[model samples]
Target: MSVGKSVRLFLSEGTPGGLITAEIMNWTGHVVAAPRSDLAKLTKRPEASRTGIYLLLGEDPDSVGGMVAYIGEGDDVSRRLYQHSRPEEQGGKDFWERAILLTSKDSNLTKAHARYLESRFIALATEAKRARLVNGTAPGQQPLPESDISDMEYFISQAQIVLPVLGVNIFRTTKPAKKSISPVTEVAAESGTESPIFEIVSKKHGIHAQAREIDGEFTVLEGSMVRKQWISTAAHTYEQLVPKLKQTGVVVDSDDGQTARFTQDYVFASPSAAAAVVHGRTANGRTEWRIPNGGINFGQWQTLGVENEPDTD
Candidate 1:
């Protein structure tokens, strides 16, 4: 008869359960566990102190070999094993008909510990079954071979298939990091100019504004567009424009302590006149600008936009 035909049993603490023994017949009518003595040792071992995993190996002289049906652990390893070995329990069934218990003295089964024991059991069981198979014993009756044990172990290793003992988790958890952002500035274009120049405007006073070059046919940055104004090709481009406009006698002042500011005469005298003085764009104004603030960048000023307009005279 197949091992599945064997009756399975579970034993735990029962009333008057210091140690108990009983036996039952398997489907094959095999005289399994009649007054088995192996269980006696478990009853004698101290309770509530031991902890660790125990392996149960079946034994049958009449069969080619036996198999391992269960793995267990407890604070009292001896008592736990004894419960499973009771004749009336799995001990009487063909499944654990000739059971041998392999146990450790530790109570808590750590993940690593459980894994190690499982691997060891499979390795040993496989080897024994292979030897039996080679000896021409009843192949079907042979205990699990080392290879079979390995297969079983592999099967259990799968997260979905393996059911860990209560209170144990196969995976660990971790936390994610937090994200933060720094202040950003915006640039807007004024009327009668080429494209609006975008700059990094500082939040603190005495900071300089950092200028950025407008790209493509369109003069605009990420968040908004510059309209009706000439924007600088780049910060350096302003250097060239300032000197030429200065030669034209345009009076300039420091806009914010950082930028060289050209009065309306330099920027809006005439569209053609402004275009003639500037090479790349009407403004070409980055170099011509300075922040009155001590340390702000033009880029920062642009980000702040007109919202940072000072009080007019």
Candidate 2:
């Protein structure tokens, strides 16, 4: 369902670590990226003078593992950069620490095209929710000929593909991290189950979860239910996490108001973190998770080795 892609990156400073420009194979779209300190130098390039869209990137002050971004389009992107480089008192933006400029190599993009691209990009970035949008108001879409609109949309598709290769991932949507497991292996010897699905359940609290190790991260799949109320002794980190997850729709409440369920796949850095969230208290995920009704804990399975464990029969 997916195809291979080729991306070419040019280091203007001729080293592996500095200002760089990227372009996808057979694509007219171009992207130039650099740290805030190199803004003046980067804007001096000829491509910066063309009509284009740009993104300003920085950390989100309110959240960890998240970023803040401001997207804009300009007739002369270089001039806009110059303006943003001014002092705060002169109306310069203060939140950005890096800049990425998007333009067409063949100089075919028009003012209307850039505006439409800006609006569409903002919508996409908002939908991705990977970054906090700093723009107070989104730029409205601009009118364009239907044929030109199709071309611009194609340009956007290519831009999305190339931006990530350039390390500009503000537009990326979140997905569970992945790891591989052999397809034909048995999961629980007692039940003779061949499926890899593992679980954590608390019948008293009406919690039942399905999880797996994915690319070194412990992932809880969507629709798995978790405890609605955390214990009073829950860790401070979990105290903060539970509400955040609920607010973000990662966990949703049931009509009975007695439980909350995961709405989407979520990956945790460690199994303990996942367990703590699921049970609403501090827990040792290694010992808490088990092959459903199989009596073997994850820690035992892991300690003895997953694929190599002898059949219990």
Write one digit per residue (lDDT tens) for candidate 1, span 237-283: 32354454344333233445433333321112222223323333443
Instruction: Output the number of the TM-score-best candidate.
Output: 2
| Candidate 2: clashing pairs of residues | 178-215, 179-215
What digit string (tens of lDDT, one per residue) describes model 2 on residues 1-313? 1244578889998975578999866678899998898887888899899999989998874542257898999999999998988888998999898899999999999999999999999998877656778788998888899878867876776776678777676665434212211122312111011224579987888889988764344677789888886876635675666776776677889876878898876766577878888888888998888988776777776666436766899
Prediction 2 TM-score vs. true: 0.72
For model 2, the stretches where C-alpha displacement exceeds 4 angstroms are 14-17, 174-202, 209-224, 229-240, 247-258, 262-276, 281-313
Model 2: how far residue 129 lies from native, Å: 1.1
Give the residue spans of candidate 1 off by over 4 A. 1-35, 47-49, 61-75, 86-112, 130-313
The predictions' CA RMSDs to the true structure, in order, are 32.8, 9.0
